[model samples]
Target: MKSEYKANSITLAGAIAMGTGVMIGAGIFALTGQIAQLAGPLFPLSFIAGALVTAFSAYTYVKMSNAYPSAGGIAMILQKAYGPTTIAAAAALLMALSMVINESLVARTFATYLLEGMGLKRTGWAVPALGVGLIVFSYFINAAGNRSVGLFSIVMAILKVGGIALFGAAALWAGGVSFEAATDGQSTQIGGFVASVALSILAFKGFTTITNSGAEVTDPNRNVGRAIIASIGICVIVYLLVAFAVGSSLTLEEIIAAKDYALAEAAGPTLGRTGFYLTVLLAIVATSSGLIASIFAVSRMLAMLTDMKLIPHSHFGMKGAIRDHTLIYTVVIAGFLTVFFDLSRIASLGAFFYLVMDIIIHWGVFRHLRHEIGAAGAVLVTAITLDIVVLSAFAVLKWQSDPLIVVISLVLMAAVFAFERFYLRHLRDGDAHHDSHAKT
Candidate 1:
């Protein structure tokens, strides 16, 4: 039997840093300009709205994690509340699909920065090579243990946060206090603003990684919950301030024209060439850290599913050479996907899986606490409603613009369910055969 793991080492600060580090990454640096183009000055407001939705969802997760301070977090809670088979299908599909998409997106962004830094043109091979290399490195670091990865994340988060703060200060020094100028001539359409909020929400997606690794955190109930709130709060403030600085520094037309990695380009005007390089370096570190964190969280989910017998136990333990082999395989798969897919496609796919999982998590919480009233019930109901609204809106938009992607996502999810059913049946049948032979 595998030895049971303990979770008394991770501190509250470490837990909060996990979420903060994961949430405040390449998305803020890259996606901010894109979202600003969509919602103009209201981009900051959209981010705030997204944070609100995430907070509600985080509340449910905190409650669930508190109830069950085990290693699996939400996956384990679902398995206990619903059962193994349901969780196996849902958790596997959600974690695998989301992590792959996230890895691809982060890799593509990292490659762009690397090419810019080296004065080399972006090529077909650049992203794949960089993506594969980073993933492999991250796998080894994680396989070493969680503490090393956690410490590395803390240092990277500090650099990213400090870099953004310095940028904001530079903007202020350059007379960037004109709020009216930032919002001038921007779209005020309510529907468009809501749609933009959905895009902005992607920037805040990493906070849930804390809840996902609840089993690893020390005093999960208290620490994880506190961490979730602190991480989201910090990201929201930093994002708003940075967005304000960027908006004040550049015009709408300039922002739209500076599409890919606009933040770094904008920073050059205020912070000069050296500051621009620093921003690019921060982008690389932020994306790399986020990708590494995703791998850690998703691998835990996979291990949990295997341990619960939802999948083959063979997939769980790190045995002999197979341990390193699995890491290499994962890196290769993620790299291949990144080298092939576009950023929008990757983001949309990631959002689809995460949104569905969020809905399921909310449902599980509500169902488990059906008898509860007042604040807990209110939180559950609000989270479910918000998730449905946001997810439905995103689905509608995607369907009208890109129906094929939406269809493919649903089909892939269904296939995962079928695979789980088939595998479990095979395992049961093999066990029965061994038992009958022993009796004979």
Candidate 2:
């Protein structure tokens, strides 16, 4: 039973690989055009803004992990702050679900880019079918355990990061560093720009992948924090390079028009067919590795939640470990999203869920755990303030642009809390009934 919960120790490099694997997968490959749509000509700058905000948000997780690292990264933080209650459970569930959403987002991006190579676009049932296939492939790779995931992540991270940076440099050189997006006269409002930050934050949120696997890292206390900072720093550099590459290679309209496969589009005109195909290959590696790392971390988080009794769990009559069952659950739900929602809707839902959970985390630490964790109140408060602002902007934009998703997000979140509250109360009543009978 204990062996089922056991995780192989990951070195600092492996941890960083895992973090960047998840970050780069969805961030750069699929999100560049989407960011451009909202941020307009200065879309490259949005990654920087997102990184700055993410740095503040990372402070809370770093402090918490340094003080008390555990397997259930975000879950531990929520429970420590709020106790065994509905708020903690519901918030933890939100984080877990958001990670699952990300898996689908990147998987769909994989499908989108792959279709580009085939001279096909993401307009039909084939997109989600391919996305679901990738998710299944990742599940097998992960079933081999942490060593497989870590080594695969390190190798894939090296390939994609180096490949992406190379593409960026080459595009800048060939395109003569044009700033066409700005001069083209297309612009965005402040709200639009702010809303784009939400997507950008999603790009960098892979750092939580590190915090979630703290128990698996060697030197969990120090290396966990180090990996988080290093991963973020590395992503900021890579994301900026790619953003500028895309901006220089294409106009704002060109970017948003090809939003689903912008990197491939940019590569084709600037780098020629070979470079274009190479970029497609890199997208495959990035999104697939990202999906692998994401599924690995998210399943672990769900298993942790079940162990803590924060969420209900049943083996459903087939499982080697709690994690084994959770892994299936993670992929099934992710595959469903891939099948139903398009990339844009998937990204939007993930952003909303993540920002809401992030606020809950910051607030929990500020109200209760700061003193025990030795975190600065100002930093925690800043994270909360920033999240609120971004989430508000995103909500308004979604309400205006795609109101259906906004309503769906609100309903889902409310329903999760309601479910959690009822489950906890039922457990209490069951225990009380047992107690009275025993006394009688």
Candidate 3:
């Protein structure tokens, strides 16, 4: 198998492009209508709230990255704080799995919009078939290596970001620039609104992808943090603009009605049928780029886990490298999820896995790595507090709305922990060489 990391393969611009590529790709297109459904008319604010919460969560990662930039990233941070134990491996796996879930969510979103634009029926095999095809397409792009991925991400990010911004601005202007959503008579459950932040957080969680690629980024220590912040900053603006655009063009009920293809639906009202198609086209570009960038990071994260011995690795007769094998693994799982799970379940599962893993990361930094990593205790504490509140709200809301997904998420997490506990037992006290220099 090939070595894990190739330092300086990604430059700062490429890093930011990849970061925003994943964020806006999955964030605005995939979650807007879903967030609207849960947060009611004021769902736009959930993006702001999610951003604020994410900024807090980012503090721990930024500090850790600056001090010790590595390809392993989140796993590295977990190991530093908790050692080579089950919790560390499990949490890192959670993060990786959550990202994989995001990939399927994005793939399905692409399929959903493509079908809508093609004037095809919203149901049947076409959606999943197309989604899986895109996942395969992305694997080829990623397999082209870092330069191809980086250049493609940068170009696509520019096109999609510009196109999406124009869509939002035009929709708002055509709809007569109004905050009518704020005067909505609808009364949504506060727990549901708070729960919406979980999805919004999922939107912003692409920032973690930057950390996973930190070792490959030029000027890793500085650029990784900068890229994370820049990506979030761009996404916050884009999400708010799009949220208001959708709110202005469509009523709360209308957005929820067309929740799967909210942007296309919104475009039809103000920008005409042509605009609707354009938005659909843009969504395809956004999701395609998002998957490519996401696949790059997820494969690397899994490869890093293998290199760290946090997870088992097998060549499986893959000719090139560990990363080569992991790339196939990432897309295959994403495609399976794309086929098996619907969009809502995929999003819900992602939110649960990600929030739980995030909470563990914050706790580790706060309880053990703060002094060593120079992370502020207050920020870490606030991050943990927010994650718990959002996660709890999400769980209760899911139980009330769709109990099956909640049960599935809980069971999967428990299963991961149990598997890790058993796997690490064979590691001779679980003191992975990667964690011997680590603290707690």
Candidate 4:
């Protein structure tokens, strides 16, 4: 049978959109209050620290993509470092599970902001309904193709960044511009600071998605690397400026006190009712954009896995009745989970998976490309080490709060690896049989 693989054609702009859109989402709007409560006045510094950590991981991704430049992005890197079966199973489970949770969180947050804007007295059903609708819409857009989703992402990213900038500037103009307050009241202990910084890093987790579609990018080697660096740089500046504005504009108590819409609440004091409404609208758009990007990336990852024969061919080769039925099944599975979970829990789990992927990619670079080391490699290595240390500390703190969830995540990852090993042995046997038949 002839192969049905289609080449990816993503430009630098589209790649940047994928990275930036994933990084800047409802988290920026909502996390400020919680982070402020945790880090006190040094929340801006936490944002900077998170950006730096992400920049380190992004550097490794860029270097690896430049060297291998395959369409599967991280999966390709994993295959080269680990092998096809490991790449397929780990990548599939990680991306699928994280995206399902991430999409649901974004949808719930979007509905919350939307309902709050319209003064709806009750939003119980609307939240889940909006989440389901967003997922269905995103899945369809992604199914249409990468270009369509990429274009939509670029537009949405612009709006999201613009909304953040406007909100920041307006807050600053209203006498909420002070760097001192961001970390002023927070604990000055190094351990506490690092823990807060790690959580803040969660806010910047989506930038790595650019490499996930390495095969589809127009110039995977050059553009993917360039886009990852450029997006992180831009994200850093935006996060800092926005954090400064939000921290300075309202007291930590006011921010923490806000429940439904923190950014809207912060803006309300500065831009009044108009600013509040605008922030809410921007949140909806940002979250929706994120949902679309997640769906697009995860679907492409599925396609890549199919091409590599990590997943069943039927997954990538649905046609007519099979295709329609598959779509229905995917929507049903994704929708049910999104409706049942809280956004923070989903985000935390997604962050954990991403951290693991980041570590794996870094190890791949260190293992396979030692001869190609340079100043960038040194920096990348340092960043990865620091990231691991930070993540470990954060995990310990989180474990202290909820040991069961952390333990379960570890078990889940281990089970995924075990399944990959079993499937790989079967694949090897099948290949041997095929070779024997050909010889006869």
Write out the backbone clash pairs for model 1. 71-215
lDDT (CA) for every model shown? 0.72, 0.89, 0.89, 0.70
The number of the candidate with the highest TM-score is 2
Candidate 1, 254-344: lDDT as tens digits: 7766645767776777777887788788788888887787776666555656666675544354554333444454566677777777666
TM-score of 1: 0.89
- The candidate that wins on lDDT is 2
Tens digits of per-residue lDDT for model 2, 132-210:
9999999998888877986777898888778888988888888878767777887667898999999999999989988
lDDT of 3 by residue, 1-440 (tens): 23546888888988887777778876788799899999988999999999999999998899999888987789999999899999999999999999999999999999999899989996779889999999999999898887788677789988877889899999998997675565668876788889999999988998888887788899888989999999899989888989999988888888888999999999998999999999999999899888888898889889888888899887887798888999999999999999999999999999999999999999988888799877778888899999999999999989999999999999999999998888888776556654875854
> Which segments of model 1 are wrong by more than 4 Å?
1-4, 143-147, 179-184, 313-326, 370-375, 428-440
RMSD of 4: 3.4
lDDT of 4: 0.70
Show where candidate 2 strays beyond 4 Å. 1-8, 437-440
- Model 4: which ten-residue window has the lowest total lDDT? 1-10
The lDDT, on a scale of 0 to 1, for candidate 3 is 0.89
Error of 1 at 277 (Å): 1.3
TM-score of each: 0.89, 0.96, 0.94, 0.87
Q: lDDT tens digits, residues 1-440, model 4?
A: 01322445667887787677887886686566656655666667878888878777677777777777766666676777666657546755675566556666677777778887888753557778877988888778767755787678889988887778777877888855655354445454466567666657767767657777666678676887888888887788788777777777676666667634677777776788888898888888898888877766665555556566665445345564332334445566668866765555555566677677667667766766645633266876787797788778767766876676687678877887787777777888999999999999
